[model samples]
Target: ASATERVHLGPTVTNPLTRHPAVAASGIASINRLSGGRAYFGIGSGDSAILNLGLRPAKLADLHEYMQAMRTLLAGESVDYKGRSIHVKWSNNQIPLVMSAEGPRTLAMAGGIADAVIVHSGLTKDVLADTIARIREGERAAGRPEGSAKVWAFAKCNISDNHDDAIDEIKMALAASGHHAFRHTLEGKNVPEELQEAVRVLQGEYVTSQHEQLGETRNKALSDELGLTDFLAERFAVAGTPDECLAKVRDIRDAGVDNLLILAISSQTDDLIRRFGEQVIARI
Candidate 1:
């Protein structure tokens, strides 16, 4: 132990460091005891972090297997595998399984297995509400009570006095975030072909007609190709003053989202974050 005492699962190919089932459980137990049951475990299927690692994406089934294995190990139960009781483990703390869900399969799995489910950024109210529905479906299948899946959302938000500047920043984030940061779940929600194409080309599979960097010259084409102009402004994120942004949050809440993890963007995040903390979030 470093006295600071930190151990993580081995590095994951897709996301951040991934813990093998046995190793992850042990570390979780260790942290739990050290923190007096205050430790938390979060599982994600490699996002851009995974992509940058030159690895394939993670699957929902894989997450479920990991969660089950962790639960079994931490509960002091030895699972029988390959003619042996494998990885005997135990802990006094209730190790919670939280899933970072995006697509339908992952959403359903989180609803069924995860103690809590977190929705990632580039969010739209319609998409958020639909994802939650899928999660609830998984809960029902598992015979769990209603609202068993605790749903939360994470977003890249930019708030500013100059709405145009804020819009530009949001556009840049959306242009790139589509590929790996967000999943394509808003395809047939009666959205435009161009916006759909933008999301699809980024996340789906479509080559650009021209050569350009994603954030530089190329993003404009990509945004235009995908028709992200209006939709990006409307559906993806909230960027504006406090009063303006709160309406967006209200819309997301009305769509059944439970909690929001806002990534406030600016030259310095403090200004935007403080404003949200003192004004937007404080009031709402």
Candidate 2:
């Protein structure tokens, strides 16, 4: 079997606020052409990209308008954007448009417009069900057919023979969820009160430069102070032996998620990818 069929390549997310819609459209279109249409465009309000620039994420209304403008430009039609007309001369709008959504409003908007929706929340039955229901509500409101928008679960996976050690690996990455902007997304999930309190404290003390990083000095201190090493290890990540991870993957698949993305929680990203492919993915 060819490796191509299993690989779908594209940006995880790009925002309308930082990059202009025409530029974004051109980038996605070029990737699609280069990859022979295996590219998908996943857009969202900026997270680290915008936050690092001392800016806020794009508004939901802006994201919707931006998506429309991108589609128009990619379809060879001139778009009236930012008081100027713009167009992409050589591109086809064949790439799938996905959205990396977290909140209910953004999730609904993605349901109505995007070909797929990616959620960063951990894989739990109740959370997955709730997220899917919100998206379905948006679809019904927009009169889109059932299953028109696919739901993808993005899980930070850290697998090892020692289950506890594997669980420990994702503690740093889980810190991102504790940030004020993203903290609410985990509110209604099956998180413990103590852990929630820890996250609240973390929101006050998080360093922007160390956002979503692993094994850093700041992260280690934070993890130690809040005692989040074991608390979030189980709830926010797919961490365990290969067998255990496979079981979690099965649960996610059975929960009606269209895709499961394993965000490798390791310094050696390439090694993790290879190991995951050989062990967990092959079994799944």
Candidate 3:
């Protein structure tokens, strides 16, 4: 129904360590103009992209500064960066900025700045509620109204009659989600005390090079060996029969997720998308 809904580069890293915030803003503004204002920028603290390069995720303060710089540049204004002035003179798109967050601090920061947030926390009712609460906390801190920032749930998905196969297919993605969400810290993440050690082991053993790979990588193997596949699936995925996936989606909607960012990581990605559109999305 809206032009802005047509395209998004959801959850790309626009951190200073990865890409200069000024350049990223100019790029998005260019794309927005070219696409008739259909483009919005989505960013996050670096994950596999930075880790694979042997770098840490951007510090929260740096991320916050980058978001501020982006806001100014995209609005056709000049901003100072490291004793230099930067501006995107050709464009003034002011496209929406969406941030991806998995942890409490990141969620709060995103709520303060991002126009929307793609939450990588699990879809369980309690977890989703807590994540939203953290975002609201940030909003309140920034003097923004309640529910000012929209929320989108990031979910790994597949549709199949064989439930076991479906689960197996997305284990690697679920593993990636766990690594992304828990690698920084386990505190306040609602991680059970009993499984904390296992989670730490998974975080250490996870292979950044094979992130989200479809095959039986070491990441998937570690998830299985650590007895984490089912737990990760329950938290981060929505894979099963069409009816089952639809029910899960409805629950997510009820939990106040304003949008769904489905990550179809299976080899049959096209088929899964088509089936989800027809069977799950259509019904919902």
Candidate 4:
């Protein structure tokens, strides 16, 4: 039996430039069926997945169109995608479409259409509130009811008794978060002025090929070299000992984050999950 109730394929790339919307929809639908209707399709406008392929991330317009086509196809309806009418014949699954967004426009668009949103912005109270407000704005603009789009706070987490080691393990993950969160624009992102330049430097230096790789990778080195490890950790991760993680999680919850999507990117991810489940989750 599956340990979790739902399985999500992404925050994977969901742009016309990468794959046909019908193919993406059909793939997720098959997962939904095989998982007994417990699958969610999580999408994003290409990051490492596209960059590694020597392609640019999808423009907002293309992402919007792709999302609409995926929604229609998954709903067992036909959609005109790039002058081609397509539909997923055997898939009529009500798969919840989750979107990962960091920038204001993307977040708003996700709120307007996605069944749920994974906010990859930051974890600070002000940032979270602002992000949610932007999502709500999108919902209103789309004529959707308040709270139509569920919000999930995206965080990098690692739990261990050795606090220092825990932090070290998550540096690469934090670097990935910073690269994603601040890559497009820094405005309205709540990044401190002092660190803005550093963020830019990190963005330019980030190696897409080494993304999320454990052990001493170039991306992980960038976090320290840019003097952004602590800041990135504070803004995007919940690491350290079990108590430390618990406190941070509580703070995030208090900031109105009801749902969390934790990225377990450490080498000891399995152990971290077991520890988190027992020490932090059990307490919460």
lDDT of model 1, residue 149? 72
Which of the numbered candidates is closest to the native, going by highest lDDT? Answer: 3
Candidate 1 least-lDDT 10 residues: 7-16
Compared with the true structure, what per-residue lDDT tens digits does model 1 show for residues 71-151?
787787776532556674555446776777766767787888877777753357667777778889989988898788777
Best-to-worst order by lDDT is 3, 4, 2, 1
Model 4, 1-284: lDDT tens digits are 14566545443435567777888888888877766777787778888878899998888888888888888898899999889999997878778888889999999999899889889999988899999999999999999998989988988999878888888988988999999889878988999999999999988999999989998899989999999999998999888989999998898888777688787877777987888889998998
lDDT of each: 0.64, 0.76, 0.86, 0.85
> How far is 273's C-alpha from truth in model 1 (Å)?
1.8
TM-score of model 2 vs. true structure: 0.90
Compose the digit string of candidate 2's lDDT tens values, residues 106-191.
77888998889987645677778878888898898899997899998887777778987776666667666545224445555545
Off by over 4 Å in 2: 1-6, 180-195, 227-231
Of the candidates numbered 1 and 2, which has the greater TM-score value? 2
Local accuracy of candidate 3 as per-residue lDDT tens digits, 1-284: 13455656423445568788777887787677667777778888888888999999988888888888888888889999767899887777768888888889999999999889989888999999999999999999999998888999989999899888888888888889899999878988988888889999988899999999988788888888888888898899999889889999999999999999898878978999999999999999
What lDDT, from 0 to 1, does candidate 4 have? Answer: 0.85
Question: What TM-score number comes out for model 3?
Answer: 0.95
> Whole-model lDDT for model 3 versus the true structure?
0.86
Question: Per-residue error at 132 for model 2, in Å?
Answer: 0.7
